[model samples]
Target: MSALDIFENDSDDTKSAIMRATYHALCEHGYANLTIQRIGDEFAKSKSLLYHHYDSKDELLVDFLEFVLEKFKADIPAEEYDDPCAHLREVLDHVVPPTLDAERYEFTSAMIELRAQAPHDEAYREQFSRNDRFFRQQFADVVRDGVETGAFRDVDPEQAAALLVTTINGSMLERVTTDDAEDAIRATRRELDAYIDSHLLAESGE
Candidate 1:
């Protein structure tokens, strides 16, 4: 599911609506041009409701980031796969998809724009740091499982996870900043798959 889909399952309908509106607005206008008025234009409720909750655009966005982070954690399929190799592939695909459609590309570009503010915004920095740690731990957990099941070579799970996470971050940055995003993504996928085959997958698993 798309990241925005998580808002649909929220218990609080108002908050859910707001988040969905914020997502669409961010995707449409981007981080630089995003405004409370623009978000309210997407929102079905009164604009005063948005102002009632947030004093400024940054305040609303920080809360939006937190909401996104929680929803993202809930969406992780950590227990969905019995095979370690398949689980690893699933994780990799989620982070770096094979294709970049228009909607997804726009969303990713907006998110990267938000990420660029991390150096200046402590809240954004903290949220992103938590996100990174969570994803890295997911990778580490799968690697540990693989090792225990003898499906992967005995490797330091933390180190392997770190490498994979770093690769994913770099690939995402390249996708947003570079013109040749598709080719770059393809190259990243190729190298990452090769890394998995040579470093993680055992002969039996392969």
Candidate 2:
């Protein structure tokens, strides 16, 4: 399943409904044009529920940010493989891939749009910052695990993690902006693979 699948069938009905509605709105209108009214339109049965809970679109979107992040974290597979490096590769496969499907592309595009607002909005800034740190640490942990388990060469985990995160973000930003997004995304995956080979993997293993 794609990354967006993680957010599906949430247990909390109200939050689930709101998050689903928000997703629909964001995909249709984008962050710049998004409004609580548009989101409520998606929740046609109880539009007033949205208004009752959230006074503003910004506040609701911020909650949506947290909800998305939590679902993302929950979706990450926890199983350990025989090869730490293989598992690390799998993690990157899921985390860094650029829009393998329409939903992923739309969700990522909306996120980038939201990120643009973070600079001026403290709530947005804080939530995005937390998400960034969380994923960076996840990446770093994978790298550190690889090194510790003899699956990778000794490397600075944090630096490697930062590099991966930056590469993925840049590629995603480029992907959403250009028409030849698939080509750009493929090139990015290739470059990231090359970088991992050159800097992270032990020569004997590959």
Candidate 3:
């Protein structure tokens, strides 16, 4: 029996299988091509089964995206830095190794495609916007804390947050699929460090 057929639409097992099938479908096919027909075929079940669990392909896709996004959020190490730049080190430490590994590089392409096409789907666009804002806010909160603690160089944390996010997003095109990204990430950090340090540090010693 197909994985979907095993769900058999009776208990929680079916719901769980639907989610699993959706994720496998997304990783293999991406959001644009994923369909109820494909999902049903995979399960040797009817398209109606998916609809019973999810309203539409978009709904399933959103669920899949949320699953991956949650995993990404969970992998982030606890914040150890009071300063934003040091917080940046936490991000780099977490992001750098996976950037080089093709097998583990699952989040980049799908995220890029969704972010780029969000404008076309009103609901998807809103959800994407919400996620973007939350990410920025979290980053800004860390930066702001940095300023209050005398760890970060004094600057507009909001602007710094935007710049920091932009830097990471831009790097995705080059780094996510690359074999060598250490130099690029390092250079970007240096420029950012100079911009921030000159303002935050004591001139006499730092």
Top TM-score prediction, candidate number: 1
Q: Tell me each candidate's RMSD, in Å, in order.
A: 1.9, 2.1, 6.7
Write the residue-wise lDDT of candidate 2 on 45-83 in tens digits.
588889899999999999999988888887777776677
> Alpha carbon lDDT of residue 11, candidate 1?
70
Q: Give stretches of model 3 more than 4 Å off.
A: 1-20, 37-49, 67-84, 96-98, 175-186, 193-206
Local error of candidate 3 at 67, Å? 4.3
Per-residue alpha-carbon lDDT of model 3 for 9-124, expressed as tens digits?
43445655676666556556665777876766666456677878777788776665565555446545674655466666666455443334432344455556666667787777
Instruction: Give the per-residue lDDT of model 1 (tens digit) for 1-206.
Output: 36656765567578888988998899899999999999999999898999999888888888888888888877765455678888888778877886777777788888889889899999889888988898789889889999998989999999999999898888878888888877888888988889898888898624
TM-score-best of 1 and 3: 1
How does residue 129 of candidate 1 score in lDDT? 95
What are the lDDT scores of the predictions, listed in order? 0.85, 0.82, 0.61
Q: What is the lDDT of residue 196 in candidate 3?
A: 58
Model 2 C-alpha RMSD vs. true structure (Å) is 2.1
- Candidates' TM-scores? 0.92, 0.91, 0.69
Residue ranges of candidate 1 with Cα displaced over 4 Å:
7-12, 78-80
Better of 1 and 2 by lDDT: 1
Span of ten consecutive residues with least summed lDDT in model 1? 1-10
